[model samples]
Target: MSPLVLGPLVRCVEATSAAVWVETAAAARVEVRAGDATGEAATFAVHGHHYALVVVDGLPIGAATAYEVLVDGVPVWPEPGSPFPPPVLTTIDETEPLRLAFGSCRTSVPHDAAGNGSHGVDALRAYAMRMADLVPAEADPDGGAPRWPDLLLFLGDQVYADETTAEMRSFITARRDIDEPPWDELRDYEEYAELYRLAWSDPAIRWLLSTLPTAMIFDDHDIRDDWNTSLTWRRAMEATSWWHDRIVAGLASYWVHQHLGNLTATERALDPLWRRVLDHEGPEELDLSEAIDAFADRADQDPTSYRWSFVRDFGNQARLVVVDSRAARVLEPGRRSIIDDEEMAWLDEQVRGGFDHLLLGTSLPFLLASGLHHLEAFNEALAAGAWGDRAARFGERLRQGVDLEHWAAFQAGFAEVSRMVVETASGRRGPAPATVTFLSGDVHHSYVSEAQHSRARRRAGAPPLQSRIVQAVCSPIRNPLPRPVRFATAFLSYGVAGVLGRGVALLARAPRPILRWSYVRGPWYDNNLATLEVHDRDLRMWWARGVVDGDDHARPRLEQVADFSLDAPERSQRRRKRRAANRSGEAPSAFARRRSISST
Candidate 1:
């Protein structure tokens, strides 16, 4: 295949410049046009399934406007049947704060398939089909529908190479039998490329990505389950020759489909792969499709070689540290770190500078539910050889990349980040910590946890790195977890957690560690959407899911599952006391990102 010119991906937009990622299935001369015959055109070529990053410079600093994509002078998307024309380039208005809707683990479930009749609205598709609508012209200021997002951040699971949809399965099953070891999933670059199409090609989703400026990161499902954990896991897989091609295709295609979309201007200017794409000027000479396959193979087999994570700071008020926890892992013994030193150092620096709020976008959350946390902890200890016999073998299997989960398994790295979150929020390193909120997913559930910082862990009157920290999770957009598993997880989290599992493993010379579940303060479920608002010095979070409303396809609102507030108790308490004393309702507008009076 050639470069998939499937997109004019509206990528990063800062104050004055916005980045648009253009790709073709094959090499093609590409030019982007904005505005009337002001005739300013920036031209580049698309590499095979590889993107050519074109910075649409000198755009307006703020406000809305629509733009166009010209591939060899042809308007591909919004060519016809597009729900909305792409948004005009606007600087990321951080002072105004951001109201972004985010969630992950979407499957290619039909938007209005009668089988899923209970929930009529496919939240992802609905957002697209509704974003750019045709309103009556008499509305003057062109009063049709509202432009949906200033930005859309997709955290992870945008595609599943491991799991296939019924439609996708038909192709896979017909082309090749999946009864083999790596059956029921994707295994190579070609397959991975198709996965991306099945995922984002939906008319509604493509509509959103075309218009709403987006930032993305990948989790395990983007490739496979428990992608990279330890050296043993890598060795276990290396036993098969097919593993080489599978991983190569996965990482190579992942670079094309997702990671490239996250690169900044300077990064692309210096990018080894894309620099050539931009410089060469023609598609045939830039035949990187085969070479990138090999490069991805090397990166996956040798995790220490290349880095996949990145960081972005939205002015000084907010900073984003995107952890590439899966790709750059140091899985070797005594050298275990979810992210190698270089990536961690970069993340540390970004978080060091103070911000009103810090958003850590790791595909996996640092904090796990009490139940899940304990289970992982027990597994960690077992894997680390606290127990004897097969306990160690079992633990090894779990950690040696059994499941690509949170940091806990990589204890040293987990401890380092946990301390970072605590210290950053406590005001020890920077300001007396503002709000350190970790935004994450991939655990197949949605949740919010508040981290209470304490100075007790330290001596003296040291400002406790103890402050309120919040962790929120949203996963598997269309794939709901089983009810039985939810209950089992609850029992394991609360009941089997702590050290009893460690004791059993030990007394039988196979002691399992204790992983208590008391820390979990919320409910868990499969398939939901989580949206949050961090304003007014208070943090509020809510989770919702799709639901059929009054037998209407034309209208649907988010149905709320839970709402919780993580306010600076010190501030909220003060506000309460002052309000009572003064009889006032002074909620700050900065924090007034509100929900409807009756949350649907």
Candidate 2:
């Protein structure tokens, strides 16, 4: 009921440092501080709606040390309570066993008051509650949720204007009637600001955001499902009377809600809008309300005018390429590209001279189920009517919101990135990482796969390729596929996709699929969480989900779903440990290979 307020994203955590990037509801002299029992330390000024990255250094290294941040010297947090939780300061630890929980495709909804049940817990929300319970009875107390994550990588769907929550509806209803053609959907920047408030402002969740060092990139749902997939999709939408307004609203809102938080201080300052923002003495930094809306309109009309994707490198070992896989799409005329030549060139150069591991954070998967992946590729070619003119109609139908053309459809870019990974590993391009892994979501299932160029590698005498490729997909933090749908997907992925892909590839005169891969991982569905680790010459990983007992809605337990190590030596060591335990007849059989989903 009272006016909602937010900003100055409290994100980006690493050992001895953290970055605070924020935008305000209004301007005020903002100051940020980080300290522990040693007393006040680390402070900076934050100009209104304009963004600033205040990095705190010299943090104590430990799992249990507590830190606090001050805004305008007011100590903006739960000294006690205002229903709004204040932020907390903690350092990120890269050593020891790592724990990270991430998933996307969430729609905000009203919380069930009685705490008996809610429309299936948001996985993030659930994790936050666990953290809350772990906190000591007072601020800066002795305990909290395992010091939280070093960094939380949010892949996509941060806010959904197209799909909203009940509380969000009331905010809309109070402002304007919902009878407009796109009324149910967001129209511009203002609506987007409010939607983000609803998404991040929940007390438990807000506290988590304040504490967790978060990184994010956008996917289609952040704007709309199947956004910018094809030229026809754009053309048809432009024909609509309300299309421009919708696009304007979507783009403007996105700049504030998602992109602002992700940019480095240097990057934001480089923007023309920020110059105007810095020029203003007023509290509001960049009043993108009108500017972003206009920018979105121009972009939709000329998709190549601006680039929305970026990359961030931490230290010299890892490179995170947050790609603009949705925007800058070349969906017109002869060819379609999710990324233009300039962007691909950037990735090529970045990945070519890499470190220990290369991470590409795209909303869509590069190696999808082979059959469906091929289906999308063939459908795209057929739609272009390279096969026959009549097939174009089917292509139009597919384009009218068909989710086609992932890496398989965009084969050229896929091949380039893959080759880069190989070259990097071979030391021809750069010092090879133990693995080149892709982290993604949107597929609604989680799995890991190993890539190879030939079946010869499958045989003993075959030579090993220079580099190896792996994909890790964790999706829809809360969306569980229906039972029947799951069965259908399994059958299709394993059986149907293979049979069907061969038929289509034969028609296209394509070379027999040179890529050979296997799902030596999982299809586990649980509104799940996972962690990825890259060490000197090995990689280790695991997945987890919340567990509950019969009808008890109070406190769900943490369940370890699956665990595996990529190093053969490590695997052999673990097996030996298990054997030793068995001989002693007192070994802990913690090998839980079973996994499933939990929902309302």
Q: Please give the distance, in angstroms, between residue 348's alpha carbon in candidate 2 and its true position after superposition.
A: 0.7
TM-score, one value per model: 0.83, 0.81
The stretch of ten residues in a row with the least summed lDDT in candidate 2 is 591-600
Q: What does each candidate score in C-alpha RMSD?
A: 5.8, 6.8
lDDT of 1 by residue, 1-600 (tens): 323346667787777677776656554555556553112223332223444556667666565556766655666645665445554555576666554556777777566545355333555654454444532111111111132445667788888877777767777777687787567677666567667777777655675676667778887777767777666776877797567767877787777767776777777677677765666653354567766766787787676566777777766556777778788888776677888888878777776636667778878877776545545656656765676767778877665443524675666677677767766766767764356777887777677766653334443454544346667777656666667867765665454553454344344332222111134345566456665555645666666655656666544444556766666646656556655644565553432223222223
Top TM-score: which candidate number? 1
Taken over the whole model, the C-alpha lDDT of each candidate is 0.62, 0.61
Clashes of each: 41, 10
Sequence-dependent TM-score of model 1: 0.83
lDDT of 2 at 230: 71
Instruction: Estimate, for each residue in 1-600, the C-alpha lDDT of model 2 and write its tens digit.
Output: 111155445665556655565443343344555553322222112212333445555666533334443444554443355443445555555444343445666667654433224435456666666666555223211122234555577888777778766677777777787886667777655666678777877776677777666777778777777777777777777787877766777676666556655666567677655445556564433344456556677876775666677776655556677777777667775666667787777777777544555677777877777676667667766777767788777776775444665766665566566666656655677555656677788877788877776463346444344445677787766556666867756764674676687588668643344456667777776666666655544565666665556654444545556665665333446567766776898744656112112111
